[model samples]
Target chain A: MAAATESFTDQAIEVAGLKVRVMQGGRGSPVVVLHHSTGGPGWIPLFERLSAQHTVVAPDMPGYGQSERPEWAREPRDLAILMNAAIDRLGLTGVTLVGLGFGGFVAAEMATMNPSRLKALVLVGAPGLQPEEGEIADQMMVDYEDYVKAGFRDEAAYTAVFGETAAQDIKTLWDFSREMTARLTWKPYMFNRRLAPLLKEVRTPTLIVWGEKDAVVPPACGRQYKRALPNARLEVVAGAGHLVELEEADRVAKLIAAHAAQA
Target chain B: MFIGYFTERPYQDPSSGYFGATGRDLTDLGMSNASYDPRLGAELYNRYLDEKVYAEEMGFDGLMLNEHHSTPFCMGGVMNVEAAILARITKKAKIVLLGNVLPIWDDPLWLAEELAEIDMISRGRLVTGWVRGTGRESVAHNAQPPFNWERFQEAHDFVVAAWTRPGPFRWEGEHYNYRYVNPWSRPYQQPHPPIWIPGVMSRNTVAWAAKHRYPYVMLATELEPTRQSYQYYDDQAKENGYESGTQNRGYLFKVHVDETEELAEAAARKYIQGPSNPFLEGNQGNVRPFIQNLPGLTSRTNLLPTVQSFALAASRGRLKEHEAATGKKAEAATASADKQDAADFLGTFTDQINKMSIITGTPKTVIPKVRHVLEYLRPGSIFFWDGDGAMTHEDSMRSLRLMGEEVIPAVREMGKSLDLSSPFEVDPRTNQPVA
Candidate 1:
């Protein structure tokens, strides 16, 4: 079956000098869901859950989803600034930042770039911090379905893309992911050696999550992340895959809540 | 867990992450000092053991290990031997040898003996995997490369022969020779630890697995292609050619979980897309030997163009020889082919290299996605690939612990009629099965 992911509501907002589309939901302490290349509109369920208590805002990065691609922010750090501006434009003061995939890179930047601005940071299935050699070898691919099929704990991500579903979510995820290729493919994924050291500068209390069976970024790489962030915590979702938070929503929510409460 | 999942080429220096020193590739030949000194390899193996032990201590049900050579990605170039050392490491967790490259390794028999020894050592916690390997890998060591699929079939038999035989064994074969082919330390598990073979172009492998009722692990080359392999196995079983349910088929791929899609995308950017390796796209030519395996295999396929380019990376002094040997007719034919096959899908051999699965998100969002795969790939067990660069140690732990505590439970609750009894049937662990 053709695997698919459901998308989320799309809203565009101009932040700083650039205009970006955001798929936002919920209301309360703001928690931003930064999507990877698969792009959002494929709103994750966790946001829905968090929306009950916290304002869960997911923005399709500049190149993906509802967000307009900005010419200025080419690197992740640049993307982080754009994210901060989006937060500011929405009038979000102290926000809990959570990023997945490439979004995690943004979260990492957010945490250290301006520690005071972000209340807490959560990096889910993030890559590129500790250059752990020869473990994680999941090849990033061409289409959205490949994202899930390549090895998501939620096989539905892949099947949903092909099967009959809420066209809205699938379309959003598809469109956003397609838009992201402009930047993600601007430079192929996974090989930049410069950013690893920058991660050390990130001082925000962070939580990194990974799929134990994550083929894309091996768990070992996740473990290396533990060493990079001084006030960071790591969790390997067992059985659940690359999308640990999606696979194990309750636990992820609990961790998010716990970390947020404590941090 | 089948065996080991290696990065393309890893850094073996002590400074590198993933606890290095053992990662050096001895066979690489290109390095001023290639091949981790077997003793140093042993030391790094100790680190591996330490890591394996930690895997068990981390509430994991199994310890994962594998082999690789000439590259730092995976050290167990020879998994059989690695298994022997692992046998003494831990008793609580299952031992998985994601695989041994049977086609390249000269002796699958010795591999079997080592497998038994390790199985006995683990007191039955052993799982074996076989693979034809990516095309580039086969050409590195084995005499027959690209078209060696036929030879792999033969080598597979000898290995299995050594494993299944009840007593002393003697075999005469085109590739291997052995007189005393018996396990002194028979495996603790009945019928030897489970066997798992995951890869592309393994129709014959699947048929063999079915005949023996062994579970097969399938991380299909691609999502769509996976269906074809699934059908092949199903048809084989329908014909009563192989075991059906009990003969587990564990599928694998990438997964990213997060509370929201946006969060996932963010993580994907850093962990997956942020670093963006510039080397993977286009004619990255990672495989030349595999192409050289068959002068003909190189011709018609889109991969040959890149193969023509990558053969040099081997660093073997003779690549120039191959380049020199390119006759005028071949060049002329290639030039003529370029014109004729203008629209042809070549040049960018690594196109399939990027943008595959990259699951990033929260468990709730990820569970259903996993269930979807269970129904599709139908793997008895599962494996995950972590992005290198180590997102952050603390963050990673939090994520992993959450994965174990949260994700597994949710997925199990979704229970589709899957057979957990099959050898390949097990829960996902850290690149290893949690038994």
Candidate 2:
């Protein structure tokens, strides 16, 4: 993996009348990093690692973090459409698209809708497919604090992201993120029922990453995703829960960098 | 002061341990259908209906009904049906649906139509209410909690439009989308039936109710907190350039009358065994601190602390008094530690009766206390909660007869003397025009 720290600058861009905050870092081929349901920790260590080898364009999805949630952005497809417009407006073609958890579902939608926009696709502990065996946890029903706890393998990992006490601003951001997830994933519950079937249409070389002890999405979900996609590789990171990117940032960055380089 | 009769119509079979050791049977989403006894349920429904009918005859101004899902706490899963039935059965008392859970209703048009039919059937005696229901209700019905508020507002707007505005219109709300919105039957009351909202001091609700100029019914809340809630509503109303008063506020109370105060205390204990506080796990009217308020349901303004203070408030008042006298908390107070002192300090039968939390006495004793509550709250309306838990049908009817004969008459006179005007009296337009 490249250096763990890289300088990043925040920029706001208009896409379909919605303001999207994108964190741009390093200098190379663009790797659009889509955040999970918890939104962004702004420029994190994972982004730092990804930025060392490749230009990391991490945009806060509409209704998450700093992005404006349009009234029309009611579903995952709406988010996908907004994202597609955002990439096109930013002129980031042949981009390696990376998404985690809820964002992975949006990424899958984007790939299915417009596969040509991406050079490769990476999904880390995504929840767009429900396995017949283990079910995805109902993130909406649980308290925000509990949901945060469920994301990491240890409490120390939580403190790393949220410090000792999550300040009011961070708490508000999480609330907004949770609300957005509810809006998008509530009806079908974290997955589009048709997403599994739709995965076949995504010709982009896909990489599915699973946290070995993921209680939230479960490893079984990764298997289902692997079986459903036409051309995909599945890699499981040990000793990590749902927040694999944060827990094993260097390992995840290596996997993504290798996958994108091979593509 | 307008007084109404209310019951949760609880299925009174506490023998089953389906409620589990914690006594939080209702909050356990898995234990819903297990605890329900249809045989007992059928009897309870008719018996509760009978009690309400007798309450109307007892000169109560309204017959209050509320809805809750997947719990033995309230059998009015569909309160509108009961309201429709009571519309034909009762002659005078207004049928107040304290409300329908707005977010859970997939079709607001159907609700509007049903409410309209009930209003027409009762000759314009419907006081419509809408509520963002409990977290348990959301879990039971799978109504998404995040959309709870939006759905409530949208459904309310749609229902109101269905009644007031010429329909066959379009509604493209964020939560609800209807291409052709129309209802065949309009409400009997001209600008639609009066809107009442019941809440447990959610400041947002108080502000919303005040802005809309609707009556805010404080649901079985503590006296001082309820006064503050009413004042909050008044403050919001003043911001919108309206002077809200007793007419714009209401309170629900658990009241049961018996031959003696001791018997009334026994009945109050039985009340704790049922929906009133049974599923709440012995917390009698104090909502379980951990589970009652869901995240995102309440405002950031001391929501959790406020809910936690129910314990502090209950403890500070009765339990503290008990502690000071008995040298132990109510829970720790033993039988040998002066039963009378314990009763006075703890939420014992005598203690509750003394505190006026559960008004239980002969008509002579109960009337004065009822008047005191009426004077204190000075509500536009009061809901006389007559039955729940194991309180027998005969006992409930007896209480009603006593209330009709004595308690209500005295309360009405007290209302007159205190210069308290009900919403119905102040806003006569809510009443149906006589044919």
Candidate 3:
């Protein structure tokens, strides 16, 4: 409805009395990307690939990036409500949903809470269930330097998160994102005990994408997601960590695009 | 003036040491469980308990106890239990639990029951205190650090309601919930026992104490900061439309006495190994900062400056030690900076006592210094810690006897001369708000 570049258009929308910043681009079917817990950096290279084929809609989750955090959205379910309202407000039906890390948890909640509108669901290195053997790395507790190091497959990919500008404001935004993520995920600690049972209600075609070496959420969690969901397939990307989408953007994007094409 | 006696009830015998085997410091969290030899611990607990019971006979108005987790520096893994034991063991002295760690408790109602029972048994002699435990406690309990303050506030509210308000009421707060919010036991004190809060000058805690009219106890913190923190509490109380006095404030310090100054200094030096060394050894990667101050635990702006000050203080102490060891005197221009750094690291126990107003002398010399600190701070109560580190039970008993005969009476006279009356002495709770 507003002026847009061929590649992308950045704007804001009000849903549930909170200002939610969203980046929209390209032309065709609508596909939304739910971001990770440590948010704020939007329109990454992977989103650029998705923009070439589909009308990609990436809304910065409330309390991260440029979005406002209303008091009601303190819990994970509150986030699911905001996502549902955002999707319904955008007038998008039968849409493909993409989630990464903290975003994956929110997307799964959205599917379970309101299963009618989603056409396809894609989860990348998502953290929502616990494993019997290995523990999900307590991402919230590590020091700053260790946190950055553990997020990527190779240390070189750290620049992708900081971006070329690498200003103090980016660090501040990242800190806020961490705080908001803690508010939502600290109690259940990155996994919901009830989430496994609720996955049975997710009837939409689903894709569970995992990194070969995800330290934050173990690859075993992806297997659990696949087994729990009624209609889902697991795909593992080689030589990447928890942020698989950022580390191997081209391949990860292609996989999601192919899934969207099938839908 | 009300006087209280305290000891950390430390397990200091290192013959069967856990930290030494792990190559970690005495305060290391990893060595917590194994730090104490149970046979020695059983003996130490009884000895300490006997010492506290004797202190009641020594004219101390209150007997103070504290809680800590995963460290031999304090064996108050559960201090309320000690309070319960003391409630029946002693008759006259107020059984002061200063206090239960609020955030670590899974259920606030259980705490209400414990406190109520203590009050009922002690026949209204319970001075209930509450605290937000150290980051180490949070780690030991695996409690969420981000919710520490929130849980503390919620649990406090719930416990107070359970004690005072008629129950069968439901609670649905952010951190706690109850379907049947009621406990059968009620406290012996009308409404509830006097709530006291002890802190090293955390601004929010001090301010909250002021708002609720809870006596704020400054524990072994530096003199100047304690002064500033007391002023902050007073200022906050004024803003809330109330007047605060000496009774509203309390101060704790290490006070050792003997026949001569040499004996007193010799005993006080033992504290260097316990509380002083831990501050110098620093965090030592034992408990991560993230585990201590989680994101969203406090207002963001306050977190960084507080953390920076703590780091700066620790480094400054190390720098001073380095200078002293190498005989490298700082230049005149940098001397002021060094002094500022030294001032920042004030929690080191020996430095706090020696530099602040920790009186270590015979009653003749000690009285004047005690008078000076009391005159300057004008607090409602003073807690004299007679035992820590390698100090034996016999040594602690002698100090208690000396305090009973000489120190307490002299300090009372000095407080009277200075016209320093405590809030309890004034009894402001019954007075209606000024119209």
Candidate 4:
């Protein structure tokens, strides 16, 4: 990620069709934060910092946090399509999409298909792009709570997930997950087997960061990403697995902050 | 030394019927509706074999074959056996068993020995493709849990050592162990056969392939991504400062050609509804640890991007469903009475999907199209999927024949006349400079 100005938190918006349990904080330019479907109160760390500088609009990304059930945004490409709808409805432009986990896939998709509206993108441990066979099958074994409990850096994030998230975030994430599952498994499990082609079209300055310990979507994914995307860079954080932002919340968030501050 | 690619599909046409026709059958069926017939599959396999023979005779650098389950799209089942068959059939062309599920099969020694036997049978004409099985495949094959790439990675290492280091050795790992790891049958090839890693657009796998300078044979990637991939591998090769892209190999766009583009397009369109659809559909994916784990037909980056773009387009309704319940335009029907048009959105989804899978045209036109893909992407070869779906024995045969006689000859002539030789001169027909 390029250099940026210092700031805190960003704005929030009520995206239509997306299940929203709650919303908060606004300031400066708008940058949407999409969290991976691994589930939790969302990537609030990135928002906690960016919200101060820009209007950090972070949604649980239907089936993620306090967000409402999405009709059916199946794969990474689907997530990008739905996000495009929300972005259009919210009338947000020059949006710098900062995504973590599967959300990184969506952000990359947005950058791929509709780069004009995007200011930049930050993807962390994104799946589907480098879709391979038998990746971290055990992690998929972990349910939302297990993921959340085992995922977060601090108890505060855990509390934020349970309290601020919709229907204690469960009802929404579950229902949204149901839709996501239908959308996902409708075929086999591929979300657009050829999403890599879009990387070249991606004009947005993309920052791909991964935790070294992030076994979910490892550092290798970041390297392939660096080669594929025209305007992209790879940053690897040590001692972080799939949950880098959570494990190294301060560091990952600060990384986002640095990218966000850049012109 | 040699790579063999076949477009054999494991499906029977309406004209024939049977299941598990060959040694490999599509087990672990996902949808109840997608059951397969083995007898018909054997018939199709024979037809595809004819094409492989034609490819070898046509003076192609190599002929390829692979595995697939349930559907004939391709998932190798006992590729070693298939390689043996190719070795028997073609005394000339390089016989490449595009792959075997290295991780899925519990024993690497068995895989190694089987490959060695095939190399002996082919008289030093086998290029091996190795990689981790997809999540679904792991579950289907009951492959020792999916996430353990390390185990498979270890197996790969063990297999290499078993081949490279000649000794009665003790091998122990989380996955497999052996008392006398060395094989009874050393491969006919001197340094064992060349290893080609078929990447599922996977970042790590691609990097590893690039880092090692293994000939990276890509299947099903689009024209643009092909360029990016070549650029990527080339950049890696250049950055790592390698003198040869030959050793850093590539392949582009699985296709089958006929006398005319119309004939080829017709054949492609036929499979578009069959293997192409299911292959793409099978690749769509789930977040389930099981599903995300597998790299299906989409292992090739070139093929994945097209699907991704189309996926984005479909989600946006940019490529609207072809028809409604009554089989009329969806939007127009919505404007009228009754909501059947709206109700049939899901069914219409299949139609929308067909738009992206098939790329049909005439031989002249397709020659340029193939060139466009080739010149732009510059893959070492093109593994034309000549037989797929219920591609009739005659049509599939026709595609192979035409591709060899008409397509290959014509493309080679065009290359010479135009001086449009590829950067990597592995393509033998043209007088291109080999890097």
Best by TM-score: 3
- Model 2, residue pairs in steric clash: B322-B345
Off by over 4 Å in 1: A1-263, B1-64, B81-86, B135-137, B240-243, B256-356, B387-396, B416-435
Q: For residues A1-263, what per-residue lDDT tens digits would candidate 2 score against the true structure?
A: 12345488889999878889988998789999898887886787887888778999999998888999876566788899999999999999889999988888889889998888899999999888776778888765665666777888888987876677676566556666776776677777787787788888877899999998888887888988888889899999888989988888889999999999998
Alpha-carbon error at A204 in model 2, in Å? Answer: 1.3
Per-residue lDDT of model 2, residues B1-435, tens digit only: 888999888766656553323455444334447656778778878887888888888889999999987666678888888898999999999999998889888888888899999899999999989998876677667776667777888899888888888978998887778898888898898888988998774567778888888889987665666776777777888898878877888999878888777777666566665455433223333333223344344433422112222332232122343333223344533335434433432455544555666777788888888888877878978998877766778778878888888888888888889977778778622323223
By lDDT, the best candidate is 2
Candidate 4 has a DockQ of 0.04
Task: Please give, for residues B100-188, the per-residue lDDT of candidate 1 as tens digits.
Answer: 76767776766676777777776787877776654335434633332345456677787666666776878877657777777566667
Q: Candidate 4 — which residues are off by over 4 angstroms? A: A1-263, B1-5, B13-28, B32-36, B70-72, B144-148, B243-247, B259-262, B275-277, B281-359, B413-435
lDDT of 1 by residue, A1-263 (tens): 11133333567678765667666666568787887655664556676667666777877677665566664444566777777777878888677888876678667766656777787888887765544655333232222345455556555754543453335456445534543443333332443456666668777788888877776666776777778777788877777777666567688887787777777
Candidate lDDT scores, in order, read 0.54, 0.76, 0.75, 0.57
- As for DockQ, the candidate ahead, 1 or 3, is 3
Predicted chain A of candidate 3: TM-score: 0.93
Native-contact recovery for every candidate?
A: 0.00, 0.25, 0.50, 0.04
User: Candidates sorted by TM-score, descending order?
Assistant: 3, 2, 4, 1
- Work out how many backbone clashes candidate 3 has: 2
The root-mean-square deviation over C-alpha atoms between each candidate and the true structure, in angstroms, is 27.3, 6.6, 5.9, 18.6
Provide the lowest-lDDT 10-residue window in model 3 chain B: B300-309
lDDT: worst 10-residue window of model 4 chain B = B295-304
